[model samples]
Target: MNQSFINTAVLLTAYDPPGPLNCVFFMLTFFLYVFTILANLILILVIYMDSSLHKPMYIFLLNLAVNGLIGCSAVCPNVMDNLLRDAQSISYGGCLLQVLFINVYASSAYAILAVMAYDRYVSICKPLQYHTIVTPSRVKLLLTVVYLIPVTLLSFQVYLTSQLPLCRFVINKLFCDNLSVVKLSCVKSALGDLYGVFIIASLVVLPFFLVLLSYIKILHVSLRASKESQKKALSTCAPHFIVFINFSVSILFSVVYNRHSTVSKYVNHLISAQFIFFPPLLHPLVYGIRTKEIRRSITKIIQRGILAGPL
Candidate 1:
């Protein structure tokens, strides 16, 4: 550990909302944490237990649920802990660990979403070669790339950020993120800034572009196909698009709220809080409700439980 890091702590100023709002936030966080876990676990179990859902798309969705669990687990506990405390804060080491997992979760989401878009493109646009192209081994490779790239990059990013000596100990947000942590350093690092830009571009912007390209091609192919084929395309693509959009809007709005000084402090906290809260909950609900296969599997499991009980 660096000398600067010794006995260091960062105050989460935004966590200290006034009056009954604190209790409201606590109850809300607890509820979200419980439900998010159950929802994501159910999604994962449904996909794992059902052999029909063992396809590349469902596999990706399973990982997405797993990622949501990781993200919410990283965030919600810390948030709940802070909300309970009079002096809401996190130790430097704890904050960095939280930063790492949250970044990995967020970045891998975009990467996986991009890969899913490609999977859909292959399925719809190149149906004949879909199985050949998206083989099990290849799916594993894509997943490996999706997770490994962000973990490696964000690990390095966190390491670089850690080395910097922070002049300030207060982060005016619900939790510590890479940008929020980086901004506290007394000495600005040009390399860190540049690399941060590169990380955003590669993990975020590039995946977004890839998703757009894949969907554009899918749209082109769907337009020329029969009505039934178009409906099939819509059915499969709608859930993923909805998930991607929901996550994007939450994150984008959080960023906007953080950067805008005119926004109220509590309002900023509330908006930013959704970034951690919504995406995890939304993932399973959208997939479980929207995707027919997963929905059927969930229904079957529920019915079996009910039927297994004594009349």
Candidate 2:
């Protein structure tokens, strides 16, 4: 609808779209995406409205929820559409947009998670100085950088992929991704490949290392303190670790499954679907249940809703 639909030369032909039980799959995926988006949206709303959650940790959590909302929005509708149609394809611009949004989601997750770990470390290891260290201005600056850097990097990726003459247009997966687009390039781009690795290292590996270091420091300080301090630190960090482990493992599986030559199509499809689908759904559950403040906030909102009765 926006600027004529320029169909790409490549078509996305796989989604098991014409398979039997499409209705079942459609309903399942449709509701899942809806629930995922709703949960994250509500989390963002709660954090934004509640003055109690204006601190750096909650801001980072809000960033994560926003990422989930955008990421799920980027991939899920296409998936549900493909489930109902025999021909699954997207426009060239559409495909680039999808890949860019997904990569932005991925890159932002890393940056936000790193910032969160640093927040936790500051709170746990330097409690007296936490306010001085992680002030509101600092949080805003970090948040802006985390979001902006990813968008800029992924935009460059889209530019690189666009320069390539796509000799082939059929992407076999349920949705578009950067790697899939890169493979369609008429010429294998050594520079693009190198830059991609660099981006991955910058966004993924470095962030993971930083988070690890923060946790190490947190652990060191927490163990030396009283049982209450240790429990407090664990409670705060466990939800984040759960999210980190879940996403890292899911992405790892997706990467390996995609790159491997011998994976069954059905299995590859499932893993790929899970990669984009599950994180958004899981985040709210883990944090809403595990984090006491968020849990209490959700509970109060539910109580008020019940008290308000049918509107």
Candidate 3:
């Protein structure tokens, strides 16, 4: 074909060209995505099915699992499909929807973690007042905010980002990351960057600080307790600590690397995967293995299933 004809044909193709190591990357990511979904789903199911788990902490965890599911759903299928297929291009509207959900999921996850931290704080620091402070009504209110705040923030972000003119249609990462998409715009507005930073600070940074503060107070309270109480406090806070460390490290590395090196695209991608996928994958294992309650609940459920089966 002539050069012009070839170029036209390429443009007419629905997807972008696959990367050189597409097969390997796709398989690895697909496995991790499956693991993440299954782990989070199992945890959610376990929490919901067990009447004993219908408490404040588990409720927050269930919320976290739901958010993780939404996040994985938003990014993984498209990424897996792109990796498997020759066509990698996403429609403009589809890209925007991906961006919106990713933001919403991320923000919701943070908010839920914050709620979990507050639950721990109330339980530990105000033992007598815990029931009144962290009631069912309060949990509902917190969950409502967690779900609504992200939707509001991302709506504004998507609206602003969609207005910017695109110089290039190629997005480097697997999914439509807000930063990567914004960087592609021909007109990079300070307003957009500021808004992005504001959202990051409020959603990610602020929650991190609050979690830290809550844990510090929790530690102090635990120190004053008897040995048994101290152990229980530590156990309750342990999963949150792991989550906080994983999330904070990922976010910190991403922010620092993005600021320092223009060629840190690959590093940013790794950080993104760690941020979204690792937590859900590891959360169940961490909590399940460490907490007797979760382990016992799972065992009981399995035992009941076996007893009820035809075989």
Candidate 4:
């Protein structure tokens, strides 16, 4: 099992039909890609330039927007291109890069969200110590860890996948995914798939559960506070909830669909689209619409052309 086998391996046995569905998919996904890029970019710009948004929560949101941009970029362009050309072929190297970027972006976003949950916990659960615990230096350190850990983990994942002998590089979804690539391996892929499962469990499921628990505790504390304080807490956490739901649903659907191909192809396609497009498109909107500071900042930027320096 080596590169030679990969060269001769028939990874994709069938060609995807260029039907009305594919054309519709192409148009829809192309529109989504444009919207995702524009929305996330606007959020990033607003966060960076808004003086009022110079807080930990907004910073976390900026991080999320950045991650969403990277994630969408990793998948959407290639998907749009393939859809337009009726091409489903992906080279082994290209597939590996896509997997690596997807993992980096998705895992980093999860890490940042976990940090945000902790931030909210400290603010709501330990208000007296919130400032001390979540200082600018500590926030910077946490963000660094959020990004670095994902890069390290994804590097190892890509290295491991590269070592495997690819039989065919045809990924079923619009983009290259880790599981799909592993399924194409000529050799036994149990180890690689097992590692992938571990990565998903640790990076995705465990953190999400912890975030949910933290929010539950935060909500309990918030309910006991004054009405003004409760409103403020909800305002801060609302955007995070929106982002969490969007990402979680997409990931859950993708994982479930990966387990069974006998299911309808259209169902898988829908899940894949959700996983690829929804986060990037909605993340910015969630934060922008839910956070007044962000909305004001965006308006100020549009009107004044320059208000504050970069973040």
lDDT of 2 at 49: 75
lDDT of 2: 0.84
lDDT string, candidate 1, 1-311, tens digits: 35667468888888654457788988988998999999999999999988999999999999999999988999998888888788888888888899999999989999999999999999999999998999999999999999999999999999999889878899988899988888888989999999999999999999999999999999999999999999999999999999989988998998887787577777778787677788999889998889888878988989988999877
Off by over 4 Å in 1: 1-3, 17-19
Kindly indicate the candidate among 1 and 2 with the higher TM-score.
1
- Residue-by-residue lDDT tens digits, candidate 2, 195-231: 8998999888999899999998988888799999888
- Better candidate number, 1 or 3, judged by TM-score: 1
Superior candidate under lDDT, 2 versus 3: 2
lDDT per model, in order? 0.89, 0.84, 0.77, 0.78
Tell me the lDDT of candidate 3: 0.77
Predicted candidate 3, C-alpha RMSD = 5.2
What would the TM-scores of all predictions be? 0.96, 0.94, 0.88, 0.88
TM-score of 2: 0.94
Would you list the rank order by lDDT, best first?
1, 2, 4, 3
